[model samples]
Target: MSDFTREPFPDRIFEDLGGAFSMGCIGGFVTNFFKGMKYSSTKMEMLSSGMLFARRAAPSLGTSFALWGGTFSCFDCLMAKLRGKEDHWNAIFSGTATGGLLAIRGGLKTSLKSAMVGGILLTIIESVSIGINRKTIQTPRQQFKEYQRFVQMSENQDKKSRSELKLSEFK
Candidate 1:
């Protein structure tokens, strides 16, 4: 079978799960840090506050991560099946949908807000990542061509400046 038609490895799903879990842990820590600061003046108090917040945040964040990551991954698989490849649009839509659904507990207004934020954030992240990846993967010939173009432009600029200087000297 062609590479395009080949099935994805099942192990990737576990990888996604692990990644989501780690991200959730980090999110929980950051969230708890700020929360800890509000009520904690002393170092010891802050530490205890953080610990308490973390304990509470872990399960909620874990569930959020699982739902977000799992939904996005599933959407990616579906997109690949339909389009022969996945794209950023799929990620944005899936993230928005997941966020909105997760926020259903808070009501419609909250869900809409969450969806908008999630969609925009994911799109920005994915766009930046794609831009960076494209920049990093330049072919040697492409690099050489860009270098040559730079050199030619510099030469032209130098020639023009020299000519202008000579004209000034004559005047």
Candidate 2:
């Protein structure tokens, strides 16, 4: 039987970008269509304006998501190479860097804020992922060992600053 319930994360940049863009397109159109409903006076006006708004907004939203996804993928790959590992830290750093760089046009404060938020978000996601993994695929002893490993890595991070740490340290 094919297990089609869960989609695997894509390894390539274009796949990530396309998926992100398509998501943005659907979100933009659906949300804008409903938004257009609030101010529309007639059914005809509501329907037409809703579609018009969606048409105008979807491409821009898709493009914006594409940019974010592309940069995130690039940064993730770079971090993986530099750190000599594929782990949650790469996602966190990539998210933070992507957010900061994308928000640069808004000035230093905005960029810093975005970076912090992005990093925190990724941290939460990775933590949740670890928990889910723990639940799904291990005996009690193995699960405990994995949890210990996660804790040890986090503690090690506190001891060694990112720049000072060697790539081998991640392994």
Candidate 3:
């Protein structure tokens, strides 16, 4: 619910799945352009180095972009539908986790063909998995609820102790 915190799994999955194919396609184009750029390294040694670097860096970069893009896009969609936080940035923040997960999963194994496939799958699968996990795990709302409960309990105990002290003084 809060920025960059885990959201409900169902929300993640639905949002990711809903836009995975289209967004993944778009992501794929950006990814491919970079991939081509890497491949065009002039020196053979540089090309190899670039390839290695790309192999390592592409996944991280792509995933980050996807995560941010997907999270925001999905968040935007959710906002539009729910009439909540229609602010542009909040929507973008919302889909970050899902998009990042998709990028990591998809980008890790990127080739021109594979990137496309991976991007598509990442969008669909990662969103669903993130959604489910968010539900099971310590989401922001859940964490806040737990924190509130702890505070309330601590306060109650303090009050009870004060009451007991007053009673003992009277006795």
Off by over 4 Å in 3: 1-44, 84-171
Candidate 1 lDDT score relative to the true structure: 0.77
lDDT to native, each model = 0.77, 0.84, 0.58
How many clashes does each candidate structure show, in the order listed? 0, 0, 9
TM-score of 3: 0.29
Ranked by lDDT, the better of candidates 2 and 3 is 2
Q: Write the number of the candidate with greater TM-score, choosing between 1 and 2.
A: 2
For candidate 3, the lDDT comes to 0.58
Candidate 1 minimal-lDDT segment of 10 residues: 1-10
Tens digit per residue, CA lDDT, model 1, 27-130: 88788767876778787688788777777887779777876787666765665567665667767776777778778899999999998988889899989978
The candidate with the higher TM-score, 1 or 3, is 1
How do the residues 41-103 of candidate 2 rate in per-residue lDDT, one tens digit apiece? 898799888888888898999899999998998898788768876777898999999989999
Pairs clashing in candidate 3?
Answer: 9-131, 9-132, 63-103, 67-99, 67-100, 71-95, 71-96, 72-91, 72-92
The TM-scores of all predictions, comma-separated, are 0.60, 0.72, 0.29
> Each candidate: RMSD to true structure?
9.3, 18.4, 12.9
